[model samples]
Target: MTLLSEFQQTQLPASYANLDPATLTQHIQAAKAQLGSKLLLLAHHYQKDEIVAQADFVGDSLQLAQLAAKNHQADYIVFCGVHFMAETADMLTAADQQVILPDLNAGCSMADMANMYQVTAAWQAIQARYPDEVMPVTYVNSSAAVKAFVGEHGGVIVTSGNAEKVLQWAFTQKQRLFFLPDQHLGRNTAYQLGVPLEQMVLWDPTQGQFKGQADQATRIILWEGWCAVHQQFNVAQIKALRVQDPAIKIIVHPECAYEVVQAADVVGSTHKIMTTVQQSPQATHWAVGTDHNLVQRMQATLPQKIDFINPIACACMTMNRIKLPHLAWCLDQLVAGQVPNQIKVDPETTEKSLSALQRMLMLS
Candidate 1:
């Protein structure tokens, strides 16, 4: 199945919400009682309804990292997100704190786009073209290896929250910047900042060269990677939705295609989408483009207000791997003094990767 329609079940989802509110409350109270200072549940906005509802802290990548890092009192951080996100949490937190994922198979396709070998070769090729005048900047939706490549080379990482500013800061530091993992975001942000489309070019991974009509290299260089989920919200889909429901406020993630972002009323991260609706005064309708779990959860909460914009539902298959069962089982193992799904990064990789994260932090 394609990334948009894919839903492969590696494990079954168990009933984590079967108990009465009072009983569920009691269990959490008891868990806290038994495992004092040993637990901190951090969930992503893209996580399922059952998992997100019970999380101690919930946010996007940067927010989750900040939460995991500052919460030094907790010994175990059960991250309800993708593998890279858990890796990020682990890198940010103290050495004593353990970051565990519910499912080891849950990975981000965007993160898989660029690895150490690929990135090194790509950077080297780009360097051959532009020499040390260019900087390597990657989106946060990438693997630690990619970040390490950037960090070790005096490059920086940019998140959706601060991509534009980071790009501005990057250019000020270096003559040129090569953005990776999401071409759409890099292009859109660049265009927004008066970086002419003529100046920006696409870096073709297969050929290892600039392959766009625009010949100028001073603008942003976008990698070929994209979020399949966000890409599903194409111009045709947006047009169809608008014709069907003109009142529906279109909201999208910045990772989406430029046309989709331009069509939407608001473009932001997943947390911003939730907060937008939460802060809306009237009963506003929304056509959201993101992970299915998050949009589904929003619809469940405000049934009359929010719905999936896509006629063919867009689902991030990797994000769906960590269902309630995997979550419960992972927590159960931790509760039983066994680390079932611990993800630890090597010190060398960690040292390099942390610098990229630090660059993003310093940019913000």
Candidate 2:
């Protein structure tokens, strides 16, 4: 369904617009009770606490998609994450099952950075230069079209947890790798693999050229795109946290800048960050660099012995857009037998994108 018209028709009824926390909770719980196993809620870790508390499964994009793929009994999958995530669930699940996004505007800035047009142009330029020596490796935080592009080019998709493995596999197939949508992730993964800074070049899609020397020796071509949220966690923030409490350990997502990642005591995905904090020693303090919601959630759920703080309080505004009202409204629609903001990828794109996703799952 069209995002604009669908949202217009299914916008939270005026009475539910300013619902109190208790009332909203009741409505959501009632709907869940009514739908039972027919409805499955998938929430990303970055989602607000209220939304996450109601989720049947909470994880990163790939993990959520995997959960949807495995659940054959749920007729409706309500994804309380960004648009691309719902699109991914739609791509991975059976045709009879429907995936709905709580908010159509909940789109990732990093994903938007590398559209099909820009990617196609960049691919053409790179192919002209390196022929078949280059392989495209897109981060999972990208659009379905971008993933399909990678699949069509015999490339694979990678997540933060499996980035190193995927990159290693890519290098085995080609002399050069074009990492997309997030420059920091590409650079960090390549650096860990012994790829020198000099050999890695940054490709500015807007400028349509490489920032550094584009010699034949260039091994990793990084796209000049990054998560607005993770980019806020800089080296200064880490240093400030260290100054305040020298004992506090700093952990961050790999999407942060090279300097930020380098400064972090630990680097991992959102799930990894959560697991680390959960398993840490008692009385240990942590300065996390990721979405604010996740850090806040960890502080609420983890043991009191483990203290958590944000290196920088940065929230992914897009992710935050999926609030309680949006979720309540979406659930009401589902209970009423109406599917609003349903995400459906075209058949061809789903097939090709699934190929890239399956490759990552198999290799990871």
Candidate 3:
């Protein structure tokens, strides 16, 4: 329940460092057996194979949060993802349920880009210029505070899987849509909806001004933020893949740059990318552009039928912070009736953020 600043000193015991991988795994399994259904461990797709192997449920942030929210039997929810994700689970779950993050330092850089102060200032400035004309839409990767801001302003939250649908719905409600903490996603989604490139303007939070043409009747105002991992995959990588194998299909997450997404043979969320690979023709080759861990998982899962390669070597370092040692330590603490790194959003923030989350769940 403490603020992130107050809980800055999240340190594990020195004894955890001395435990071997086998011992750590054994301890984790033992703790799980002891807690049984009362403990729920959630891992994001970007998490390492070891962490995912230990998770009771594995999916994207929204999927994990929805699972945590609906689980009435779980007393403890340990999220093996970034800080924002754990904060989201806290917002969605019942008041009696507790959510924990394995590492306090695991935070999304994109989410950190658009803090509440910058967002509040931008909202006020935009509204001052065009009152009641803008509808805010934040990606699920953002902090709970940003989601609360969107909800309080009559906006909705969206995930990569349902961004296009949610944006389409937003366009019907307001004259302009303001997407936060991920410019690439906003631009890619807006462009897919037939919004002209010239009509979209980038709002640079650091500069505190619009980057593109300000007078072209902007329909989508994209905040100047992006995923560090996805941005590494560029059009050049796709070009190289095409040169290597004309038959190879390139699939990328929508978080990639507009040019990269446009060049990709298929553009979708992580789930869609995985599904595409699963349903593809046997012995097909694929070049994937997303978190390296997820692609590695797919490669391992479909080893016999498909050959998967990372178009670029990139991984979300924040997600990778939740290693075996951290997981084992967290589970040990939970089993011993101690909750370390518990993530709890303020009551007011949770109330407002849930409104946006609920709206997205209904629409998606």
Candidate 4:
């Protein structure tokens, strides 16, 4: 893949840096006129406010995938999120239509934590120790190769919304299960399923070892990884907000650290958080703990009393890499009949990867 050069980044057109709304609107109109209406733009909530403002659809990973599948008329689907999201959209949508990611380097830190090589070695080690009892289950925030590996080992992909239910389902199928790539989500979900905190163990991929373990009956196995943005939310933040304004309701994502989640009044995905705020009639203030973009969007779209649980907002810097200039540049290249930075997963991997994703959609 030929990506942006360092020289290009430093020497972008001076016009782009100072694009006013009028000029931006003109450029966008010209692009649409050239590219036609058969183009769809999907933005994740974690994306910058400028990018989200132009998105045709905005939501979590699953919502974005489903949105792409339903837009059959679109000749191009440009994802404003990370690499995994574009790959997942490609796998779920029509094969001939193009799926382009604005920036190739915009990838999830949590997803990269586990890879095919490390997972294979870990699987072999688990079988050697526990043998038939350990089943492999993975979070959706992982690479396609990891998902296929899970499928081959008879595991499934779980999202934040369905993790607890999936773990309960996994235990019914196997005596024990290994949940990968987001230890906090896995551990918290399993603990909710009545699996003792002592029973849950973490598999450290770097060390190629597991955390201290007790009995064989522990169903949920966790990987030592996390979302850097979600990990920033703290119990202390919640306490300070409580002391300052006890009337405020603290809503957090399930991806937050266990103690922060426990302190939150409502726990859900980014989409769920938005819905909760939109429908609530209590008129109570809100302190949200999630990605910065979604929180900002809430503060902008809602006139109600709501604020961040943490005063200093934390953002995923990588997600901020996909700016409007990048989106316009990528689409402009495609419109000019140059296929640049088009993400194509190998056909063999796509076939198996579909199974893992389909299992989630079916069970969802």
TM, every model: 0.88, 0.95, 0.96, 0.92
lDDT accuracy of residue 109 in candidate 1:
87
**Candidate with the larger TM-score of 2 and 3:** 3
lDDT of 1 by residue, 1-364 (tens): 1121222333433455454555544555465467766899888888777678778888888788778767889889888888878888888888988887877778888878776666777778777777777888888787767777788888888888788888888878887778997999898888777787778888777666667653435666788889888878877877788788887788888999988888889988777788888788556878888888888877777644776778576588888776655666566567789776777776787899888888887777
lDDT by residue for model 4 (1-364), tens = 2112211222335566577765665665567677776778899989988788777888897688778767788888889998788777777777787787777778889988998778988898888878788878888888877877887778888888777677788889998889889998887888778878878877889998877773575666788999999988899989999999878899998888889989999998777888899888747699999888888888888866888887676788889888777766666666778555666666776787777777777776
> What is the per-residue lDDT of model 2 for residues 299-347, given as tens digits with 9 covering 90 to 100?
7777733333344466899888888888888888899998888887889
Please report the TM-score between candidate 1 and the true structure.
0.88
The 10-residue segment of model 3 with minimum total lDDT is 303-312
Superior candidate under TM-score, 3 versus 4: 3
TM value for model 4: 0.92
Candidate 2's TM-score: 0.95
Alpha carbon lDDT of each predicted model: 0.77, 0.85, 0.86, 0.79
* Model 4, residue pairs in steric clash: none
Worst 10 residues of 4 by lDDT: 1-10
Candidate 4, residue 265: how far the Cα is off, in Å: 0.8
Using lDDT as the measure, the top candidate is 3
CA shift of 286, model 4, Å: 0.9
Candidate 1: give the clashing pairs: none
Q: Which tens-of-lDDT digit does each residue in 207-246 have in candidate 3?
A: 7887867663889889999999887877776787789888
